[model samples]
Target: MTKRNKLVFAICAVIIGIIAGMVFVFFNQEDLINEDEAKAIVTERYGGSVEAVEEGADDDIYIVNVEGDTGTHKITINRHDSSVEAIETIAKPSEDTAADDSNTSQEQNEGTENDEPSEPEKTEDESDTAPSKKEEPAESNEPEILTVEQAENAAANEVGGNNVYSTWSGEGQNREYYILQIVDGDDEGALVSLNGVTGQVNKVVYLDVSDDDYGNIEQLIYEANTYADMVDGRYIEFDDEYFDEEEDDDYEDDED
Candidate 1:
């Protein structure tokens, strides 16, 4: 055979080998764990209902990021055999976890007023000497702004969800608007950043809520990333395995 014929045969052989390898891998692995089963396993092992469960890199494994009374547990399940691959426990639960941000901040700030130093009391002798300066009404120049209710309406209009709740979350410049939490209706559990002054809906962080369907999780993650892109804002975080950039780069290089 000519050199050209040999090259064609070699290319075809390589293609066939790749196809066969993929088929072998697929067939050897038993059925993967369903959403219910995966959650059950996580709860059994980690001692709580699974808060946030995700399929690991390319669906090869499953990830469960859950926090309980003990602490946070990140459990990995091999999709092939439906067995636990590794269990990592964090005693502190320091990461940007699945736990509600609103709840966390409230707990942190409730006791802050007590932590400040109290002012010293005025002595009877010094009180008489102290200047009795007359107080003047300050002039107001700030522009009229949207109310919290109006901001919540704007956020709900921007994203189709039940406007469950909203709170003044930040301080100073950071305290632009109410951080709105929408849930139950259309948008799973969305964290909407609403600009109270300008009445602009800024960023939204999509989150997972347990449902009968696993597609709920997929849609939550997809919207979380895609919607963030639409507004040029940041979305929610996922495990490293969920986005195996190295594996994707390798596949792209191979295709080229």
Candidate 2:
């Protein structure tokens, strides 16, 4: 085909591919759980229409959430057969009347209090009948963060370093961790991370830095992780179409 025609063909092919993918997805959605059926099942048992229907990540089930005059409920149903798998009461709207009930309960409690005798004040002369219960100790609020010694030991055991060069603490996903620099053994140029709380080894990394990179080893490790993340993100998209010289030439000719 001519250059202009070839470019037109490539554009047409891309559009067709996108449309085909959309049609496939649309039809496949019809085979999954029906939201209408889920609503009907919830309304029959609970006397209310379903508020929302959400498909679960699991292939076989759907979550049907319902809100009614009396309460709110979460119902699980099978995707293929529409059978009820589980029902859970999430909230009770009926509890709104609790304020009026509480007032009546308070009046009754006051009447009972008037009729009952008060306990005599504790006396120094009278012996106590029951001993007071001891209070338990309060838990510490401080996090179980890793210490340098613990991090060094954990890294040493994993990488076989007799001594630690340097250490620093940092935060990981849910908790704190420590990275230790190792030397005097086979792990001379290795870096290791240890969990702050459990003292378990988290990661081991190596770096062969030149004189120009950095004298500070910790900064180099951080930069290495950042570079690795960048390289990883580059592969997240597979754009082989960019390398097609035929398409490029066609576009260049059309522009000219």
- On a 0 to 100 scale, what is the lDDT of residue 96 in model 1? 57
For model 1, the local distance difference test gives 0.66
Q: In model 2, what lDDT does residue 185 have?
A: 42
What are the TM-scores, per candidate, against the unseen true structure? 0.28, 0.31
- lDDT score, residue 146, model 2? 62
**Candidate 1 segments whose C-alpha is farther than 4 A from its true place:** 28-36, 45-47, 55-60, 91-256
Q: What are the per-residue Cα lDDT tens digits for candidate 2 across 1-256? A: 7999999999999999999999998887677667777788778877776778888886668798888766788999887777888989898876556666788899999999999988988786565765778899899786666666776777777767555355554554345343444444443355565567787665555544445434665566665444434444321222223336657999999999
Error of 2 at 49 (Å): 99
Q: What CA root-mean-square deviation does each model show from the true structure? A: 47.7, 42.5
Reference-based lDDT, each prediction: 0.66, 0.66
TM value for model 1: 0.28
**Clashing residue pair totals per candidate (backbone < 3 A):** 0, 0
Error of model 1, residue 220, in angstroms:
99
